[model samples]
Target: MPDQAERLRELVRHWELRRKQTRRTIAVASGKGGVGKTNLTVNLALALKEEGRSVTLLDADLGLANVDVVLGIPTTYTLAHVTRQEKNWQK
Candidate 1:
């Protein structure tokens, strides 16, 4: 059996390959706003980025965006821009 670390590395590699080929985007949502969903998402994103994935987090919660808050990130853009068609979904 493979060691745990090796298995994780292989998993992440496979994930990154798929992410790159598919150019995937995912959302995390919940009816309960304060349930730490954003925190978990941001942590996973940062972990992937730290492991060398080029990641972008979109706070798609309309009026209640929170990924930036949990990740301590400040952005110059928002879903408002997208709603207004001011920007396409690119980084």
Candidate 2:
């Protein structure tokens, strides 16, 4: 049986092949707080980027956008702005 790293590599390879046809989304969530969801999401995005894939990490938490805090990126706009059509989501 393949190890954890090997399984992840295989999954990445599968995604890489499908990436040319369409985009993908991965969500990290937990019903409880302080469960390291943000940490895992950030690290997973970074790892995917390191593997030569384009990744966009979107934090949908309207109240506390913790992903921005974890990444040390000050967000001037969020999904709310995008929903209102005031900001482009791709930007």
Candidate 3:
């Protein structure tokens, strides 16, 4: 069991190293709403993209999703749709 655990730890460390070399990830979160968390996230993504960094913004706020609205992009699908199998994320 200990050997297996050590192997898992080594695998995790290897993947973590690869992940750091690949790209950066940022998560903007706040316990309170209407505090501009979404706004900041969108702006940060735009700034990163402007600097030639690839950016993919995910609006995880299912209850009060406003990232698309703030960015002036209409959403035909959401995480809920994906969860319900109504839409495929790859599409």
Candidate 4:
């Protein structure tokens, strides 16, 4: 169990290092609903992609998930699946 914990820590550290090496990160957040946070995030991702930038938009709105709907993309899995160990992020 100690070895597994160490491995997980190492993996987290590696990802943190990689994130630090990235060029930019954009986080769209809102304290209230009825705002265009999802739309803005989607549009920003699209604009960044159009400019030839690699963009990974994580729809973390667990309560009201609609980013996939707005983008017309269907998702078979979500963070819940990953948390429940039903799906792997690599997949």
- Per-residue lDDT tens digits for candidate 3, residues 1-91, read 4798899999999997786579767899889988989889998999988977778888887788888889998998888998899988777
Clashes of each: 0, 0, 0, 0
lDDT-wise, the better of 2 and 3 is 2
| TM-score of each model, paired residue for residue | 0.66, 0.72, 0.70, 0.69
lDDT of each: 0.81, 0.86, 0.86, 0.85
lDDT of 4 by residue, 1-91 (tens): 4788899999999998897568886888889996999889999999989977788888877778888899898988887888899998776
Instruction: Write candidate 1's Cα lDDT for 2-86 as tens digits.
Output: 8999999999999978877776677777888788887888888989899877788777887888767766768678899988999
Worst 10 residues of 1 by lDDT: 66-75
Cα-based lDDT at residue 76, candidate 2: 89
Indicate the residue-level lDDT of 68 in model 3: 84
**lDDT agreement of model 2 with the native:** 0.86
Cα shift from native, residue 79, model 2 (Å): 1.4
User: Which candidate do you rate higher for TM-score, 2 or 3?
Assistant: 2
Please give, for residues 1-91, the per-residue lDDT of candidate 2 as tens digits: 7899999999999997787668788988888888888889999999999988889989887777788888888878888999899999876
**Any idea how many clashes model 1 has?**
0
Model 1 whole-model lDDT (C-alpha atoms): 0.81
TM-score of 1: 0.66
Best by TM-score: 2
